[model samples]
Target chain A: MWDKRSDMIVHEQDPFNAEPTPQVLAESDITPVDAFYSRNHGPIPAITADDWRLDVSGRVERPHVFNLDEIRQRFTTHAVTATLQCAGNRRAGLIDVRPIPGEDPWGSGAVSTAEWRGARLADILDAVGAEDDPDLHVAFTGPDVSEVATPPQPYGSSIDIAKARSGEVLLAWGMNCQPLPRIHGGPVRIVVPGYIGARSVKWVTAITVIDAPTDNYFQASAYRILAPDADPGAAGPGDGISLSTLPLNCDVLTHSDGDRVPAGPVTVGGYAQPGNGRRIERVDVSTDGGTTWNQAELDLPYGPWAWCRWTHTLCARPGPLSLVIRAFDDTATTQPETPAAVWNPKGYLNNSWPRMTLHVT
Target chain B: MWDKRSDMIVHEQDPFNAEPTPQVLAESDITPVDAFYSRNHGPIPAITADDWRLDVSGRVERPHVFNLDEIRQRFTTHAVTATLQCAGNRRAGLIDVRPIPGEDPWGSGAVSTAEWRGARLADILDAVGAEDDPDLHVAFTGPDVSEVATPPQPYGSSIDIAKARSGEVLLAWGMNCQPLPRIHGGPVRIVVPGYIGARSVKWVTAITVIDAPTDNYFQASAYRILAPDADPGAAGPGDGISLSTLPLNCDVLTHSDGDRVPAGPVTVGGYAQPGNGRRIERVDVSTDGGTTWNQAELDLPYGPWAWCRWTHTLCARPGPLSLVIRAFDDTATTQPETPAAVWNPKGYLNNSWPRMTLHVT
Candidate 1:
């Protein structure tokens, strides 16, 4: 039924997992909503904007239900241009270092940037009862179900309440100046800026303030990177090598791996994103395995949560290219050389150096 | 053996772990060397300036042993006014929430600021082989041994080479315009600015460039916060947490907790320190459980690694005063409300709000 665009790579069919090609991504500064990557864990719940009701309960002063129009009328709306990246954005890169990860073989296409307009989560929560009594975590529950479950199960996760009230988190109802789409957690969803995409629950209907972390399987069990020898696919509760905020990463998107390019002056470029609201300090590009390097020009003035696009021009000889690119965030943490350097058993936080091999003709 | 200071709370018997009293700490802008806190894991090793030799080895293009005189002669001498805090500085605060931590019952007296004069660590490492070959870590070995160490095991730790080359780290031979003393690291020791005091590696004898982390007990085992039930006293290797930098924190230096003072027109003051090279942005003080917070005036013109002193005037009326002070760093992270909020097993990062109660007469 998802028939708007057919040019993207479809990794899954039922729940719709796909990403646009690198050529399409480099064509513009802000990725258009249609060409943006879709990483859905379940089938889209076709709930209308009028029918959706947001229920906030648990330890709050005011346990109330809010419709879409009421939420908009009650709180002042704000817009934020940010990037939302899947935790498994470059999961495919880990296979070269070790065995395949538990998730889909994700390439570099599982990230997208957009302008979100909605009420600040802190503002909406202020209307409720955070002032009367402080809580520890804010849990979000979406009305999506497991693929094999006979009865529908909600997808939920929690973030620190302090983070929720930080004004960056949003109860988003608009994306890219349009109504939120079902494929992208539409009608209503929560946008937790600067954290992993999993924490940004889609199709959100319930928000509960609790004294502890979420007990949902997606949060307490599935999202963590267990011990290196543990089986991630069958992970139990409470191992907790937690994967909450993303790490600094960059991807060389202009050229496909092992593709043949003409031996002459060529421009190689990609996108670099930093985690924990850190700015991208610098990105270095090397063609001969980092022996010598040149700084890539960063396309700046982007939002703090959006990715910085970097491009560098270099001449390619008629031999194999040992291209390597690394990014340093404002926090002084550098991107690892390869996926193996940061490999966990679950292979989460895959912010390693993304390389490309181009054979010159 | 331990006879230097007596007024402060002493935690250890041999190495003389002690912290200055709040009144003593608030006496002056810069803490006096004698009034400064001492945090030692072993007996202080007395090494004269003539006997001390600093060795540079491991995976280098050049390896040399330089005496104290040669080190001062070879490199340019610079001075930095910085603050150093032990990881378990406020260990006593943890017991209010959970079980008692495995370390000393330290109060809030383990931080002090000083002007240190030394040769830059970056300039020294640049001379001895990072240019010829690449390395990941720079391991620092101290001459002091633990009480139970059979063969005089030296305390050792490693830091990222990028951090070593950051230029703020120093191979110090002097402190506060005087020769480095045995109580501190001397005649030559590393001053790793912006990192924890543990990584500074007191009484440093050897600096080795390596491909991985240090194999010493302090580096591989003791410094991290384990699970709540884990044995911090006898920690094992590979727990994966290494506390390199301090957290944003503030401590009231003028008044001790539960100390009785005259009521009305009282001025409350404290010191604020930010972690990881971030400067203190603002200090917030509230005498009424944060219902209303007043911004405190901060003393400026301080180094990035040093603490910023803040003072505030408040009129205290009668009985029990619930005073809460918190600090915000430039990176936007703030101090937690209480120690219970961030209770770790080893009591490593005690950036919780340091409170003071005065029974006004």
Candidate 2:
């Protein structure tokens, strides 16, 4: 649907716009959704699930619309598997001494983990009836449109109404278990798994509900994060802040010292999360960085919003060292011991403290 | 060069192994070597720089070989940019179950950042001649060959000769500044920029100087790291631990809580490094994980093998949160707050403490 004279050109390498290309997981716990990673923002629209539908409408009192098998036989499906990460994934490690605009330079594969399924935006906002308004604010909208004139803000995002009635916000359709690929977001989309995939909107097509929260343009101009001194082009529109649900950060995104196994064995795996409703309860690791610490080994427990997997092991003797890891949750919270005091400037939410640097003989 | 009759049907959706694709860094500061994100292990070998050369040879007395323009006009080039990562950059966040076993399920794009350039393996081991037995060791080799077998010890990896005479290693031949790409390792490679890009050996060819380490198969059976409690399919090769440099990790890929700017103003950014000689310095950030910490904002000055970029800002408000970041070096050392203390099983070096989650609307 983008042939406005064939220039096309999306090729920004297109791993959905960022950093992936690492491969090697053959048969290791399902991540095959066409290799996931499609952080789309354009091109992928081509819809047709019998002309989709959804709709719902503002201040709902019953402003319904459904379609798509009447919202999949009027709700009740559910499934999870979590992991979605992409608040700009690894924005190429942002530094910008000068050049700093935006749009995918991601180096962490944006993040993926599937298994989704559908229904349950708290039962489709209780079948389009929701409207007790505690300051409402649901807003989704996607079927993607906009050819400039200030496009770049139709992707939409908004949440709050107690996390949209917190039934774990769904409306997905399927992923990992199939069905849902119109560049991901397919016949129905909006999983919000562990949040941040631009609020999981994809082809959504209206939800509204807002009473006073969405000034549109991606909630009043671009998913933001300014103010370590603010001045994102002189901030404007309600002037920033709308990244919907996520906080309790944890990111190690790979660190390795392995492959020596003779100093009496070693192990040290990673991945941890705690952005929404925080969870991750433990991951310590230290190969001399904390002096002495070592607990890692968690894996399997997911959903307080997903992402967890830890591991550790030690025994030394080789040369050049320094390996560290840290994490804790369930609310005791922890992690943060450097990055010179949390620098900032729209690089938003940089959780620090995880180091690796090895050289064993 | 694959075409032995050309049937070529590996295809598992082949983005190699796919999933975890998050690119989007138009530019915040470099990271654009074709958007950098590769992590190969084979396939992508098509050398021809007038039939490359290199050589050098053992306990040297002049076993010279050079070529590549006499190792680029008899040495002295230098460059840096650093940040090579990939110790399984975020191995699918460490797979919570049934995932973990030999390489490449990287979600964090296995890390990238370029700039490189060459000349200086301690100035070609001081013009081919160092081995007064400072415990020998040196090694290197690599025209890459090994589909298994060759065990009488002969692959390679060894460093101590006073860290190969310091001079920051090199032999690169550009990247980020261009040239060098035969899927990386072009007509000349070997940066060791900060160590651990598998010791920066690509197409290299030979360097030797040994007296001890060279059990090849990537230093005695694949760059090791087992024994957290061992048992990665019954751990072998003496049971693990042998990567050469890169530990002092810290990753918090990305976390969002911004939208233009308002609600106190927020910002957070990522990337840190310390492996091999170590040096990060500081990075703290905590939206409420470490209870209350905040220091992030480092960038530039990098040299313990490059990769620094940090940022932080906070004050937003509107529910759910968690954001943590930690990093240290210059000796304060740090990071180690969980991951079961540091479990092990060849998952090697897992730096901990970098949680990120946000939901501030």
Candidate 3:
């Protein structure tokens, strides 16, 4: 809990995974480093900027190792305001549908926005003479070894070469104009904006340009959407759809489930985030189980890759109240209506309309 | 009628707009030129390759004009097997929800895949020393004047500078390895793969780089998603979300509405297309009204930009049966349940679950 705030809703203690509360997430456009969600598969590794090194190899003209200073001095610094959401950001919704044992039930707070500053990964690739093949992938491996991974290997993941060279991916050493925190990616991490936070590997130590996606346990086996009945343990590599980008998702922040309030006017507020560089065009709230939907006012004060804050006001009567919310990106793609529609064995990407039931007095 | 086949479902006669039958569309992996859909706002212009010239201007170091031969010889030829979908491909579904006046009730035939070969638009932009501004837009204009415009202007539309430079947009002189047909932008047309077909301006005669989206009637006023209550007549330019990419949509091609079928073991087939560089990951078929769902087999024999053909077999009892189809892209974003949820005045992008009713004999 070195970098985590006391108010975080702790889901794990050994690997130190936790998410900020709803109020903390909605308080500012950029979440404070301490209040940002921390999702880690292994214990946080301790490394100083001077000691850390990034090894660049695989499908490159020449393999090279660069220290933090070399990376900072070689490439021009760039900053991108991006929102990163955990693949299991809203697993609590899926848990309510059925029992997903041995998984963290993350609420809606597992997403946060920060201004990440670093050298563009494209520039680094260009310097390393990385092959321009779109079929290749840029894989990253951190030093922290995860006991959760089969055979207990280091946490690793990858992104397609096209995304790596899109000029948005970053090798970051700074967050919110401050030195990167250990709980988050420390000295340098790959900040893959618009993709799942898992792809943005933290505590980076290696960058390999490979022909296929890294066969790391995290990339090949976990973070996939398998059939609901498929046993995850028996599943082999490349079994299910390996998730990359965050799906179109929104969450209500003004009220929590089972909260009691005086019956009258209720203003609901939330944040909407889209995947794959798409912008949130509209968000809708349904007070009566999605039979009818009312559009909410959308505000994207942050950059394109950040989340859009939405709010709507409606009158409520005294009784059990149900509020459901969904979002549409620029492509007009909406979320699945029910968790049962998108439920998987791993309990990942529960982007269904989050139904929050509250007791109104 | 000049470029359309006898089997085409003609929606308009003056502008010569039509779509091929489902059987024609499903016959081949690359849709035949005669079977491809044609959506025109004005009479097709007749311009031989010798008479055609493309003028490139606006935010560039120097304006340049090139004839068809020069364009073909100057840049490296690139062929993209892409699917072009009209924004109004599935407008009939929206028409079922509510009457959208002055719009063609297009069935799912407004989309077709072809091998488009031409010079890369990025090469053209690079040759003209185009300003690399992400905020700027690349506009294209054709020679055919439209009476539908406020004061009668040529058909025009635009894509973002980033997309134009992404190396996918093409100035095509060939379709399916044959000389481009007169009706489908014969001499030279812009083939913007993965975007709404309107952006692939047919009969392109001019290309301009600008700071903002073109104020052309089609780009600014038409092809947008307006509020259900907003009046198109009173709406000005930049009124609503101007559509660019295709939405995640699927269509049932094997059976039309109100069809008669056998009592058991019926195979339903269709196509699914995703927008903004995403791939169709799953397609679900529901025999009932979406209460239960079964997955369909997905095949993308065509390249990434082409439609994914899907099929599912289900048993039926003797009586009336209803089949609903929905698609999920790689991001797990599914279509809205009902057309009413996405109904607009222009009847564009009706990506709802297409419901087909059949009587089991």
The candidate that achieves the highest DockQ relative to the unseen native structure: 3
Question: Fnat for model 2?
Answer: 0.03
**Candidate 2 accuracy as lDDT:** 0.61
Give residue A189's error in model 1 in angstroms. Answer: 1.1
- Per-residue lDDT for B218-332 in model 1, tens only? 7787677554445665566756256676766789989888888787888888799877766776777777765446778999836777889999998887898878887755433
lDDT of 1 by residue, A37-79 (tens): 8877787789999999999988778889999999999899998
Measured against the native two-chain assembly using Cα atoms, what DockQ does each of the candidate structures obtain, in the order listed? 0.02, 0.03, 0.37
Best by TM-score: 3
List where candidate 3 sits over 4 angstroms from the true fold: A1-6, A46-56, A59-79, A117-134, A165-167, A263-265, A286-295, A315-322, A357-361, B46-53, B59-78, B117-119, B122-135, B176-179, B286-295, B314-322
Interface root-mean-square deviation, candidate 1:
18.6
Residues B1-361 of candidate 2 have per-residue lDDT tens digits of 2211122112122222222222232134456655555544434456788788878887888888888888888777888667777665555545432356655455544666777888878888878777566788787876655443333332345565766777777778777677777656787877666656766777777888888767666655565655344566654553355566665667655553322333557666777776565577667776656645666888874455667878777777876667767676543334554443333454444566656566666
- Predicted model 2 interface RMSD: 11.3
Stretches of candidate 1 above 4 Å error? A131-135, A148-152, B1-361
Given candidate 1, what's the lDDT at residue A195? 81
lDDT of 1: 0.77
Candidate order by lDDT, highest to lowest? 3, 1, 2
Classified by CAPRI criteria, candidate 1 counts as: incorrect
| Model 3: lDDT of residue B176 | 94
- Order of models, best DockQ first: 3, 2, 1
Query: Quality of candidate 3's docking, in CAPRI categories?
Result: acceptable
